[model samples]
Target: MPLKSTLAVPITDDPSLPVVTFRFWLISFFFTALGATVQQYYFFRSSSGTYSIFFVNLVSFSLGKAMARTLSERKFTLLGQTFSLNPGPFNIKEHALIGIAVSTGAGSAYAIDILSATDLFLGYRINALGSILLIITTQCCGYGMAGLLRRYLVYPAEMVWWSNLVQVVFYNTMHNTQDFQSIRLIRGWSRMKFFWIVTVTVFLYQFIPQWLAPILVYFDWLCWIRPFDMNFWAFFSSISGGGILSLSFDWTSIGGATMYLPLSAQLCSFAGVIVNYWIILPIMWMNNYMGVKAIGKPLTTKLFYEETGLPFNIKPFLNQDYSVNETLYEQGPPANMAPMYALGFMTSFMGLAACCTHVGFFHGREIWRNWKQAVGSDQEDIHTRMMRVYPEVPQLWYAGFYLVMAVLAAVACEFYVDLRYLLPGKPIANMTFKCYGYMAMSQCNLLLSDLKLGHYMKIPPRSMFVGQIWGTVVGCFFNYLTMILIINSQRDALDGTKPDANGLWTGQRVQTFWGSGLIYGALGPARMFALDGKYWFVYYGFLIGFLGPIVLWALSKKFPQYRWWSKLNVAIFAGGLHNFPNGYAMGILVSLITALVFQWFLFRYHKAWWTRYTFILSAALDAGAAFTGLIIFLFLGGGLSPKLAVNVPSWWGNYYTPEGDNGPYLAVDRCGAANNAWTSGAEL
Candidate 1:
């Protein structure tokens, strides 16, 4: 096709390597559980905690390599099949499997949120078995859809899904080290040696944010400034979203992501974030557009209930009848959404319309043509051709995963929410879409990496499929159990409606999830689009959001001269719109800066330095971040109450939200109560 990059990635044509050995299984089983446990355990914490997949990859590879070096290949017969405890060597494929499993928890799953919501708020007791199955259905259902789209997403050479490029560079640099000639420009050791050295150093350095001075994770200079206006404070101080200074010290939060995203996508998303969250959100809320007063309640559900004159009384409303209580609903006015929430929703709506239009005009014909040539010669690509010797994973296999998830989903949807009345169909669908959106996206993106890795190492495509499929399936089991334990242990603290005793356990993310469920399920976004609705502008978001891409496309076609015009990706803007400045303002800024410096500049001119150091540096950050998160959970107040753990002193960093570990009292107004919360920080 086009000339390959100036940066060279040497590939291995060798096929014989140990993937599923005793060491592989041993490490996979243990870490998969550990990662899942670590993932869910931190859900109750005040910070936005998540395990890094880069961390997982590094750890898994190290373990796998150790096993290869130590354990001898002992061949044995089991049943009728001959097997070896250690096959040949620690291969990328097996390491990829472990990374795949850990990455399963890489996305925001709504099922876990559903578990927390019902248990914490609705008080619906879904037993352990039901809880386990519920996660499987919602999480696994997307794998099947991904399997079907494999040829489209995985086969195409140009479909070099940008995020995977980082992992690819790492995997190749480590596993195929012989090819990387040591250019004696400015290095001490080989790339592999340098990588390990950096990884170890950063791991040690992670303790700053891990257990000691957790406030180091976030920095906001303007947090000290106050006549104590909650609205003004929200713009600068709020860590969850909307800010001018978001210097997230946590590598997992911002550093690693900066190294992975493509330059174009990063630029587009950054522009969108500034336009929406920084500029328009303040202007709209300050002027009280459509009476939208939502700074005191940043997460928006409480504001919604108060605006509608119905503050959620779960017991009275969550009756035996699971149907929407129109009589109860009519007792108050219609629901009012927060500006940010409404914005995210409107962008989501826009995304739906824009994706259809963009895909139809751009890729519809190509896809349709490909579908017709199911097994035709057109299916060939350089990677696919190289992998042709390996057998293909039968579509039937993917279909099987799909069918199992569907049956479990149906039962889970029915029993998980209610027993006597059986939960309504809409909530089940809502949670499924919610979980599947992130699940499919994260997992499918993971699939792209696997394909590239497989191609590099000459792994059988079918074999790769088995590893990912089984890995995800196993991950769901532990993640669900972890959720169950966390929910049972801290019922009161995890409830967003109430305050945790020492702000140790805010369940902030789940609060958002629970609120999102209510919005999509009970008080749907459609109501906001109604003629007399308080959020009439939400409809305009969809209309405007839809038009943005159409205009760009029309311009690109009409002029055909400005080559860069077509590259203005609407998907990036739609994604950026859905997740605006508020949710990840500081993190986005960090990524933009990093991308601009390294990706935009170094990649363009100093290509050798860019290729040599970027991914290794990123991996170091991510590995350190993961270790930090795990240590925080194991040692610090990951789940323990403030009585048992050390709390960081109240400072500007922790003053953002009450859910933060060292946080001061939040800036929320009580439901139709006296407006005194903005004063004296948490009534202290």
Candidate 2:
């Protein structure tokens, strides 16, 4: 089904509404600081949480209104321009600006991965100036790319960027004072009423799963049926096993962009999850294919030694300068990953290759037409026509910004570059290269999404540009500050010396990042993916990815009557499959169910209710879960004082008894015997 513009976003705008007001700057920075700190803090935890823009929109609306009621409207002249502290009213434009800034700053800076991985894993800390420069330049490069590509990605109506619609609906529900027709199914409640109701309800209920009874987060009840059975637990454990028919009551697990992304896309992703987790991983583990029995579990994110079941030792492989000791590395046993981890890596390769071909096949002609049309002359809809009143950002500004950022990025990267190998084995240098090279492309996608939001809201391009710059700069500093504090305070827990009793400081995120540094930096791809290596087949994923979309495109063209063929997005399917390998397997299943209920069922049968309340419901639930998680972290989970020492009473539901080889986080799957080889029943 095609997306209806009137249902998803507003078709009209008010030029009289004040934007870039005092309300925008204050709320934007305050939340930026708070969001960056909280997001960075949660980055190390096993059940990581995101401080989303929906939370900012809900809280900032109140703050903006409070300012409007209290602040004096006295006009003042500054630099030959008149400005007022208070605007006429708290308008949607200011609200949109605040949301944009919060969204920009809320994400943990990508460079922090480099900092944490190097400092914790390699015992090498990057200097402060270099770190800051790396963060800023990497982020700014994306801004420039977004500005350059806005014509095709942001301006086209077909490029819906589905998740942004939730934010748009939330803004309209909050600011648009007109009452909507009440649905009897929801007990005659308006959108605003429903938003507050859902927010407060979810906020109160989140305590049960987040802290009181944490076991509900991954309610793998099937594991409880035969807790002593290794194969049974291996088949159904939501924490470490295949997670077949697992359930989760945790909102953080169930209530993300799942409620908003297109249902077809979610189904495509679910198909990937089914193939990888249920079929491929199980067959490999059960059959012990490719010496899989030596790797212990069928699914994990950790790398292991084939000779021993213990985690792989990368330290001995490194030389004084952190380069791979080729002779010593060659003599040692190859590091092996669980079949699931290896398959996930293949999916990542496939998704990357598939994305290129998918976009070219689906959108090549439209993009070419958009490129040929001049910037000011490519108006297609009423939104574009109304936007013509505001001056567009000049192309030269983006070109100059890209040039400056590119130079700064190179300079910062050079600070660590040794005058040795072309691609040095220095993990820090490897990370820096990855951040500037790969992360910049992701950043462009992110900024292009934000620019689409701006286009939808009819915001002036200049104001959106300034707000993004301000938010990004503010976020980078705070993210760095928080990372420093955590590393200093919880070094022992983060470095694997001491286990966090509450499971809050596992450093799993950095561990994953550091693992990549070892693979690509210390142990170059030549050795890791050699023709004779166990992972030689992984490279085939690239060919599979490239060909999958082309096949789908051909089928779609051949069977024009079959609309479903066109909707099956191969890139989305591959990306979705990769997400389920970790603890998110159950969550992805739950998310697909939720998408079916809202995006498909209600959307088809209850159009009025779906249009008015679906996005509101998503935003409210996210805000509630986030706010509760923040409180639990601060009060019960050791955010404020380390000595506070609060914990939930141990019971059958929340019990965690550490046995052999189960990773951090409690689960009912206590099958220590599964750690041994299935064939010989002996510890490898």
Can you give the lDDT of residue 570 in candidate 1?
79
What lDDT score goes with residue 34 in model 1? 70
Tell me the TM-score of each prediction against the true structure: 0.82, 0.86
lDDT (Cα, 0-100) at 595 in candidate 2: 83
Give per-residue CA lDDT, model 2, range 1-684, as digits (tens).
Answer: 245455778788888788899888898999998888878877765555556566677678888988999999999999998999996789998999888887888878888888888788778787888888878887778877889888777776655677778678768867884443333327777555677788899999989877777667667777666654555556666655677777778887776577667788888988888777667766776777655666556665556776666777778877777677778877977776666666777888899899999889977886665455534454485666778888899988888888998898777767643313437355556766787777689888888888989889889998988889889999999889878877876777677666443333567667767777767776666666788988888787799889998999999899888878757888888886686443445565676788898888888899887776666677788777777876766667655666654666665555654531223323433332432323333222
TM-score of 2: 0.86
Give the local distance difference test score of model 1: 0.60
lDDT of 1 by residue, 1-684 (tens): 323311333433555665656776678677777767666665665444445666567667777877778886778998998988778678777776566555654443447877777677767667878877877666666677777887766665544454555566767755766555453324567555665677777777766554444445545445546525556555654343356554555555565656656788788877777777677766765676545553343334443454443445434444354446656776765556566766776777777777777676656676666555544545455556667767787899888878887887778766664533223323434654577567666665555666655555556767666666666667777777667656655666677544543333456666667666666665555655566775666666667666777788789889888877646877677777766412545455666777888877898999888776776667666655555665555445534433445555544433334353222333221111123445533220
Clashing residue pairs in candidate 1 (N, C-alpha, C atoms within 3 angstroms)? 241-582, 242-582, 246-586
Q: Assess the local accuracy of residue 477 in candidate 2 as a C-alpha lDDT between 0 and 100.
A: 93
Residue pairs in steric clash, candidate 2? none
lDDT of 2 at 436: 76
Estimate the lDDT of model 2.
0.73
Best by TM-score: 2
